[model samples]
Target: MTLTRQVVSFSVIGVCSGALTLVIYVMARDWWSPVVANLVALTAATLFNTEANRRLTFGTPRRRGLAHVQSAVLFAAHYALTSCALLGLGVLVPAPSRTLELTVLLTATLVGTVGRFLLLRGWVFKKAA
Candidate 1:
């Protein structure tokens, strides 16, 4: 059950992120486009990511408990890391080099996705101690 929920959660968010990136790129060609796209992605990621992991992945309810707090904290950390990674990568790779821009975005997504999975598995969405 948890596995199924996790798969769905990840799938939805991943698709949304890809769509968001394409939209942002189409709308703006400035250096700020990547930043804007990432910010939007983080918003969706944080909300759905928290709810899915807390309620579905861990089979928890939206009640006041350690799980709730843990979920918020975990999602917050993910948002922070994602924002930093996207911003830093933008600086390192810049926007004119579309290849580098895409690579950095992909790398940041890969690392952040792994980190979120691990954190949810070991801490936020784990069996309550």
Candidate 2:
């Protein structure tokens, strides 16, 4: 697929994944702390996002070991940003409203999405020579 097409596909997937994460967090928050809920949501979305990007966005039909590793590293970076946002919210507001928490998470996720796209396109899923 062309780079443009790949980016478009990735963006669609990213939106779905972000929405999924929010839903997961909302459902999980009832039973788990915000941090733990976010963790679970991120983990679930990462697993699906990696495979979807590999097959649909990057057009890597065959399984590549390095891709999985790269995806994990990408998620780690994303998680770090998200965790910091959560931490900062806690510190800043002490008792931030639920809407505020969700807003912070969505913003963090969007920032991470930009970085993730760069790494996925320019590094992890680069075209073979």
Go through the candidates in order and give the C-alpha RMSD of each one to the true structure.
4.2, 1.2
Please report, in order, the local distance difference test score of every candidate based on alpha carbons: 0.61, 0.91
lDDT of each residue in 1-129, candidate 2, tens digit only: 887998899999999999999999999988997889999999999988988898899887545678988889998999999989999999999998889999999999999999999999888888877
User: lDDT tens string, model 1, 1-129?
Assistant: 557767677667656655565455534535556666566655555565566556545565445366557756755665576567657876665544755655666666667777776776687656655
The estimated TM-scores of all candidates read 0.58, 0.94
- Which segments of model 2 are wrong by more than 4 Å? 62-64
Alpha-carbon runs more than 4 Å astray in model 1: 2-33, 62-72, 87-94, 97-99
Q: Backbone collision count in every prediction?
A: 0, 0
